[model samples]
Target: MVLLFRNLALLLAILLPQTVQAELVTKYDPVIYDPEVPEIVAIVGTIDARTPLNFSRALEEMPRATEVILASDGGSVLPALTIAREIDRLKLNTTILPDTGCYSACAFLFFAGNERASSGELGVHQISSDSGDLESGQLALSDMMDVLSDYNVPDDVIVDMLRTPPEEMHIYTPEQLATLGIIGTSSSRVAKPTTPTADMSKKDLAAAFVQDFNRLWSLPNAQAVDTLAEKYALTVNYYGKSLTNFAVIEDKRAFAERWPLREYLIEPGSTAINCDELTCRVETIVAWQTSAPERGARSRGRALQSLTLVWNGSGFRISVEDGTVLERQ
Candidate 1:
């Protein structure tokens, strides 16, 4: 009788749903939310072979989600691959949160999602051994190639990617990955309104300025900078000079001091530019003319332009940000 009771207890434990385990674990490792992004389900931690078990539960327990937010450094390849397979099977949308990334093996998971997106800052490279050295083992290379093949990654790309040392494995830019048909269109580049017309009062303008400035500063890409400049009717400093030479800087004061105008040019993220009579802004973007970095045509070009403005009830003020290179200026 005693033996039967013990056996019954063990069976019950084994039959308990994995969802219960997820609930228990989440109490210790909770997912944090970003108010700026309300729709994303943040997955914050190292993703390894062990992650699939918890992820399976997360998927089962969380409400039917349109997208999954993944952020992690590379971990065990086998487990990452498993997670990737599940993401594909589920046809879930995936995205990398800004200032976060899915590196190394974790990148494979990103590619497997039905629709891959990033807020910004998605880095990918190669895997190294536990000893922090390149795995010269034949099996490691073969296994890596197998994993790449599972994702339908081209052999040539795999060869070129692995040609570098593990420490120097090439990272893919969002554009590069998109061109390769890996991650789909990126969502971080969309233009946003700086402020609504209804909130253009003095206190509101100042508050919105600081808020937008901080957020833009966090992801200070040239594209974002350009959008902010256009919405505000501002000018960017290019090589210590004004941006009027390269691009059209709108004359908002001449148009009329107002909150919302009829026509406006903006960059990717929609930031409502306030080109009135009081404050102004501008943008400077340095980019290569060509795709190949070694080619002279690919040399970085400095472009300056006007972006934003504000109505001080007197005259327009232009407050443009500095044109500093985000990478290899």
Candidate 2:
């Protein structure tokens, strides 16, 4: 009778597949990369529920890290807030590299940095709960606001956050971030060439604008492009294509990465300048060579470009730029 009972229990166990629970799995595990600077620790991954613990372990191992470089898409909000709190306690500087992203709850970690620097994407949106309870959502938002307030984030930034929907994100430009007081103006990540004074002659302004534009292509940075965009409403007509300010900046970034600038020269007799009290326009022909060596017997292609600059009250900035390959020998 005991053996019969044991056999019956085994049969029941075999029949009850639904009694077993599946283990929950996280999408990504946090990892620290080799430091570019001795005091900087680079971390990359999703900020899931386990991230805080993982990050804590990383911090424990690299207790001397004074800065953190982050690239993440974000995940569980509670863990993200916990990680942010840890970052604040450590008083570490935070930076995001160009072409990378720190989105959603990841932005909270960025804001927690004592000194924040972002040359890449920093995106934010409204926080929501999976349960879809209105009260829960409100409580979550309130908690987020408290966190931001504790970090001294400006009121305007909070407003922006509130307005952004959970399904969509707002990507902050360096200039916008500075204006919102989220980042310091003098931060290396957002530094750009100074604009020319209003008193300068249109010719001088045009010359300065050209010089800066060339510098932009030589070493492209989003901050510099954003500065130029803010100073003058940029409109580019390139190779029969029309580009807005953001598009122009993105194109320049892509171009710079693909072919680093070796040398650039503006043709002497190819420049024309016109000005009025409210605005000025400069048109010029420029030439450039890339650092990449030529393939086979062909020389590296040289770009001949036509550019236009417009001046508002602030200073001159690129308004239109068109380019074509002038030489490939």
Candidate 3:
């Protein structure tokens, strides 16, 4: 009887399920885009089972983080939902840059942002179970709908999400995203400058400034540098003398030669702008790297800089710049 009991116990142990360990592969880091602006917390990689704990740790480490930038390929569902709720709870603004990609479960967290903006792709697909069970799939879909509803996502958007298959993706365009209230909303918090421009709204001008600045750093060649320099007034200085005419091209080329491969990483929501009728000031922290790591001479670091832009009748141009570049410790 004892032997039979032991055999039965062994069979039961073999049949019963064991606790599954959380698989976390997400990378969280603090990014200071501008010393004067609030810090941005970056969350990258796959949101797996361990993401919830990882995100919790990040929040605990950077309690002052008021914004979050996400670049993820997606992963497990429950953990993503947990992260989304946490983001909502913290009331952080979330943003995805034009070069970044957020998909599947990552979209959930993006949608949960109190003030969300996406200049890149936000992809979604139906939720499914690994076992391909219809009941489990339905339950998963239902749970997703519940969360989406809680986030106040539109019914049409939720319908489209349901229609998309797990194997395929439905990427939301900027226009569609606007309709979904994900972007294009001007913050009431932005104080209007004493002299606002009539030609372009402050929001549009700010967007243009960010886009142009990004383009300027992507390929810091002679032509790119020249275009950026043209945006600066003739009185703008490089080292000491003004960067005007031939001096502009020469100085830019010299700088480009030193840093053959330059890259600037901007933290989302780190851009702070103050514009008046004639001038605007933009400040941000940038992680600037001016070397090719593959070539064994890479020097990468962060700096805080401020650009003063003046409206030149037709458009805005840089009038002055605080040349101080404080390297990040």
Best by lDDT: 3
Cα lDDT of model 3 by residue, 12-51, tens digit:
2222224423222224421212222225555666777777
Model 2: worst 10 consecutive residues (lDDT sum): 1-10
lDDT of 2 by residue, 85-139 (tens): 9889988888876556778888899988988987677888888864689987777
- Report backbone clashes per prediction: 45, 1, 3
Q: Sorted by TM-score, highest first, which candidate order results?
A: 2, 3, 1
What TM-score would each prediction reach against the true structure? Answer: 0.43, 0.48, 0.45
lDDT for 309 in candidate 3 is: 77
lDDT of 2: 0.63
lDDT by residue (tens digit), candidate 1, 1-329: 11112232222232234444321224212232322233344455666545777776655555465566666666677677777777778777777654455666766777666777764444445555544445544555567667666556633245435655656545555544443446653332222223335746543454344444434322323323333332333344433556652242333222222212121122343233333345544343323221332332222333333334454332233444444444432
The order of the candidates by lDDT, greatest first, is: 3, 2, 1
Which residue pairs show backbone clashes in model 3?
33-285, 34-285, 195-277
